[model samples]
Target: MDAEYQSFIKTLRAGHKPEFPADAKSIEYARLLDAQDKLSFLRANFNIPTRSPLRKRALDGTVPGAVKQLDISNGTKHVKGDAKEDAPSIYFVGNSLGAQPKCVRQYLNAQLETWASIGVNGHFTSLDNSPLTAWQDMAADCAQQSLDLVGAASASEVIYMNTLTVNLHLMMASFYRPTERRHKIIAEWKPFPSDSYAIASQLQWHGLSPSTSLVEIHPDPETMYISTEHILSVIDEHADSTALLLLPGIQYYTGQLFNIPLITSHARARGITVGWDLAHAVGNAELFLHAWDVDFAVWCTYKYLNAGPGAIAGAFVHERHHHHGHHHHSTPDPEKGVDVVGYLPRLAGWYGADKTTRFNMDKVFRPAEGAHGWQMSNPSVVDLACVRAALAVFGQTDMRALRDKAVVLTGYLEWLLMGLLKDNFGEPAFRIITPGNPLERGSHLSLLLRPGLLDRVSETLAAGGVVVDVRKPDVIRVAPVPMYCRFEDVWGFIEVLKTALEEAR
Candidate 1:
């Protein structure tokens, strides 16, 4: 391992004193943490799934007798060694797919009712008894709610739009302006596949080869964590030729939270546009995009935000980019001819046209002010409703409170896992690849397990009702979301993991 990473781990181990007694694997410590937890009540806001008897039977390799002979009461059948009907599974996959909120159904039902009774009028007119306004304004309302989450200076700087990859393409269309002298794009060596593909294709669109036009920064071979120094060094090395620097706010695999403000300032100083893929960072980290002066950003709502699958994503364009002096027109500008000062090239659509003259059907395209000017079509009202429903739960508490609880919750999980390793194997059976500093990472922890053991460990965990996600090769990622997960859940996961490891061995 690199000297920097070794020192980091040593400092992490020294700084983290166990909050519970040495016998932290016990349930008593778990319950004590739960009792003192201020956010415990929030867990009731979600609908956690219970293990079904059939699932348990399958896990245990048992076959149920004739289904017709089963006893049924209150819509639940009696089965031997059945799990309690209301018991929630120990969910640790919030980083991948957050647990559904109970209010989603309520919000969807409202939209359905409005659509049924109001018909086409629902597009522009609000139903009398409904909480939602006209369907046309749904995206705008959701965008307003997301402003604080992303720390935008104004609602106009943020917009609710298409999926992550789609929005990424849109942002790149506007921001990735390559020049002869500065045509290179700086990015991580292992970005999410979609991001890599988009960047590569963008280079190809400009008739440039990926090998020469792209500069990817790799982590030290020994320590998987990429150091901030290394990232800045690459930026400085290619400052003269780099046109754009695109990276994730929180690395998807390692759960490392990059220094956004620091990197943005450095890139902007070099006269390079910077963009962030905040898919994992949106609700997971506290961001200040406007204050940091990021050129642009895009994110998906489905992961930490708890919006349903394929939920509508969001985008950010700095307010300085909203200059209206360069509106597209049929006639050339009388004063400056065709070249307008401070104009950004956008793939214009009618939805992005000025609201006042939008329906007038003029040939000239007068773009709407700010981020809304980037919209191509009306967003899905159903998707906006789902996002609004999820944001409502977030409205109950501020990000600071949630993040504060997260540090303790995740630290507790890490402590218990370390204790398990020491007591059971007396050596490192697995290594935590995620950065140990609470300030440097989010809620998820990525464990790099022994070779060929990840699948067996994950399967054993699933059989025991502990749900986590396994990345390819040898990593298992677990996240204890602060909003819904409890200290007891972390403790229970560790105990189950110990047993799972033993079974795998």
Candidate 2:
């Protein structure tokens, strides 16, 4: 851990105190402080960006590389800026929508000019790097980073591609085989709506009604997360009839990091095809899609990946699934065990019209090998460019180090929130719905607003320039993203939240 980060952790633990909102009673500040201290120590090791200019200056005053520069605006009303500010007002509410990355625009601009000047010729003539070489050369690097983030063994099993759900539907088409005995699918209810619709329709296409065809695991009414044990039990009970297990790597609303390896391993052991929607966890946490033996997985790159909005997403299919009997290779390379070229996807395009013999084009669709087999269409160059730029930065750092820092930072934030609750609302007033253990969650904390005070507290925080996201009726989510969120930001957010609570009252 960096000394500066260590110091920040110590300060957050011992120095900052949670302030109680007026009109609240029966809270214990001291006990909360002790818990906060322990959490601060845990997260005191990563580079978290601070939005406060004053804090940044203070943090950088002594340490040389204590801070990082991001072009974010600081406005109380909109939380928008071109430069970091003191206590940035513009909270990133739309992480589910997209997170702004400083490098993506520049990358996209460069690609735009290439496309404009050379037209199709840019495929071979682009400056610095040729367009044809782009996917071939860059694919390995991009795939490697993505694989690392997702916990894959080799880059061979992963490939960058189209949007998230698109890849999901594609992988489903190939992997999902419904029979009379095991015709049902299992997934979370209301899973991003699109996933729900897709799965429902998949069952419907097989002449199965959603009411009986899909098993949705709903959260307990009072809690925001589902239990892994409960899910496993459900699978076991339905193992005979459950044909597939489709789950999100992380729950979008609660920010819960599911026990993916455990669940996937269990389901695979029972002959169930397992796939994951990693929209929230792709870059936010550590994963092992290959080692976990996940039959297939897909994710969008815009969120934690720092890729700009609409950036192309990627998917992974275990290499084991591509060899031996399935998707037999043509003149398969005997040396590499599996033909690398054979695994490369040849989607619906003129290029696949049997460059050697046009008559072969008459054959029915045969899926590509490995992860590339999941691709349905070519990706946008601009989107690929943006993702490449963002991933370039990620390549420079250690993902494990980042994950360690994130665990601590998010834990610290939760500790601080707990302190605020203890000092202000007291027991029975409000409770945290996010898991208490850091291992069960990610970088965000879901604070369930007390009954009757949800709107007021959230509104007060927003008005006072405290940037936390609200999830409808009650929950307030605060994410101290490790890559860009700072320790002081955690402290400052809690401080301002106290004031906001007071003003709300």
Candidate 3:
């Protein structure tokens, strides 16, 4: 421990906080805390960006902050061109996009070398030294690696496939079987826009009016917080007519981690299919889709999974639904379907076909059992490579251990912000919109700055190399991700934000 903190603790032993500024208020205190962290070593697995090249945007690295017209389809890439001289940025936006894993480069390079050496032969061949499997088994390989992350019953219960919304669309195709009497879908009031659009469009496509068929459980307007009780009441109100209940495991904007097991049990008992948009929750929160009996779930890996932007997404089809979805006689996606031998009805692809007969050139479609049956196309091998690398870091530790770190890390950030945001006039400049209860949140804390202070605060924060998600008009979502963020980063953010607020005032 730092001498100052040690002294402070001695003072606290006498039942008082140290009066000196050198106590818990110094960067040394943050450093002391970081020095004791067991997970601090985990930070080395990521490529943190240095301040000097944070704005690079061109092939020759010329743009600043302006969105570049480059091929970022692979995802946001972080670098350290001037890392030697400059300090690393305090990256607190993992809730938006996670930092690039250091191993992603190695994994991608392996894929490239294999392809160059043995073109067609690479599909079935994996180098002994490579950290990946043969091309055909890549998605399943990722799923196996992710079983513990999603809390699946077995490898067969999980699969990595299309992006979040597409998987949602696919899962909804089978699970959102609407009848004349039970056609309504229950959702939260403030789902990420894409989710809202997907749900509405699905209703429209089914010839159902979204105005009547989509039931949104409204949040308390003053705080924009959705309570578990409110969600339950909404489910009760529409239980008989609701065919599906889809909500985010963690609300992206508010960072509200829903009570997955409770909500799933409540809705499913009412005969409603339960699905979760776990885009922000997968790697951020502890999940038990199988144990909780979730009907299905969809998630994007770009956020907390650190698999880069536009990474191949993931889906969970509870083992119970693997073969029985066709019993509902749901409508097909039209563009991609085949008369599969399996009992379930899913959009089929050659790659989704059972491997034994995948090369048989037969007309009959035989989907591999369980979640693999849901695959719609050949997954991007490069994307799978990135996910493999990301999972490798996760493979070193489980979510239980990560969650323990997250609670303390985010709690430290909240504790520091609450104590430090005092202005000369006495009233604080911001209020935390995310729930203070640790069980109800994940890694993010949504700080709603008092009206009119956002612009100056954001400018200062960006200038100080403090990356955060800014919600225009007032809020900033700061995520102290346990995977790579430090207690020092949290302290740095608070120091920057506190100064920014004082200056704005």
Candidate 4:
């Protein structure tokens, strides 16, 4: 740790919890905390322009204070009105949806205006003189960003598409071709509801019973996170009949960064087609899909990527599996019990027309190279514009610098929460379900509230204007997004949390 950090810790340990302004007291204490480094890092890494009109309005200076003072009895007040103090709510639900960057609105508006002026002929308009409706290149650009995020070899191997479940279903249609002998799809026991449902539906569509074809991997009885070693062992045990292994890059509930390389490697070695749900991993962790030889993966851009809710999602197919210029290396072997119809289903639309004569023909279908081959419908123009705006920030920033900042910010948040929990509720009031090791956890910390305090604590925190989210029954997920969240935010969160706990008691 740096000297500044050590000094800050000393000040924090001195035991004088900072005081927040009474009008919006919950967030004021954060200013007293030594969060300069964390805040500086965010300002440095993200293109958070303070002087821009878009940013100025999005930030609405002083709104954060109002958020800190909000009461839940009033009901989700952030959207209720124009209260400036309500801005710094210390949002922790990046796992659900990320706060919008101030710049995205301007970007979207530019596109909207361009569309309005050019009308139906916007495709060949003068400004850029490029086809506005041509989503092909947009898909390619998003693929490149997703590739860098997941360590894929080429842009062609990835594709941007609909939401997580929709993309998962599409990939399953192409990859999860199961046979009677090796037809089981192995997934986490508590996999996100959408994933579980999609996998079940895919199996049912193939005339197979989910009970016999779906394999759910459970963690040890009392634990929420799965053990990497155990997952590999299960794959080994079920290798004979396991056709696919679908796992998440990070467990959403536990914030556990699973051993992607090891797990995917083992499954692939045993002829299992491995895919990943990266809803929680895409922008939070470093990945190496190409190096790891993962068959495919999908993610939602709304979370850490800061794309708007229900924004366009992304998918990655290993370059080895993509037929960019050449033919597919080899069809998945049938002995592995993966079924293939020997042809990709065709699309019926003007965009799907064969490129050579597409302009002259009303209908034709010519599959593009690699993962682009998977695109069936036109991309969402608005969503792509927002994502393009977000990726522009990444273009200016290095992931390594962001990752370094993340380590400190998240670690500090965890440390403060544990300390506060110990001081008030004693040892076992709540447990950090997110791994203690930095390597095992990502930006979020999932705190498992003590048995009976879950409801009251959650309700109290929201009423107190603490913007963390709770998974029903026990888990409270707190994310200190390094790009936007400050160390002061982390400190303030703990203070409010302690007050909430006391109030609950």
Q: Pick by lDDT: which candidate is best?
A: 3
Name the candidate, 2 or 3, with the larger lDDT value.
3
lDDT of 3 by residue, 1-505 (tens): 4564345434433333344443556788788778866688998888776576676555543222223433444654533345332577899999888998878878999999999888888789888999989998999899999888999999888899989899999888878878878899999888899999999999998999888899988888888789999999999999898889999999988888889999999988988889999998999888989999998999999999999989999999998766633333445432222223335565677777777888897677776778888887878899999999999999988997788667767766776776776424576788888887777888999989889999999999988899999998899999999999998998899888877887888
Of 2 and 3, the candidate ranking higher by TM-score: 3
The pairs that clash in candidate 1 are none
Backbone clashes under 3 angstroms, per model:
0, 13, 0, 12
Rank the candidate models, highest lDDT first. Answer: 3, 1, 4, 2
The sequence of per-residue lDDT tens digits that candidate 2 reaches over residues 340-400 is 4444332343222322332365464455445654544445676777777777666656567
- Model 1: how large is the Cα RMSD against the reference? 6.5
Residue 482's lDDT in candidate 4: 67
Q: Estimate each model's TM-score.
A: 0.89, 0.76, 0.88, 0.81
Consecutive 10-residue window with the lowest summed lDDT within model 4: 46-55
Model 2 / residue 208 / CA error / Å: 0.8
| TM-score for candidate 3 | 0.88
Q: Model 2: what TM-score? A: 0.76
Local distance difference test values of all predictions, in order: 0.81, 0.64, 0.82, 0.69
User: What is the Å distance of residue 444 in model 2 from its true position?
Assistant: 1.1
Tell me the lDDT of model 1 at 469.
84
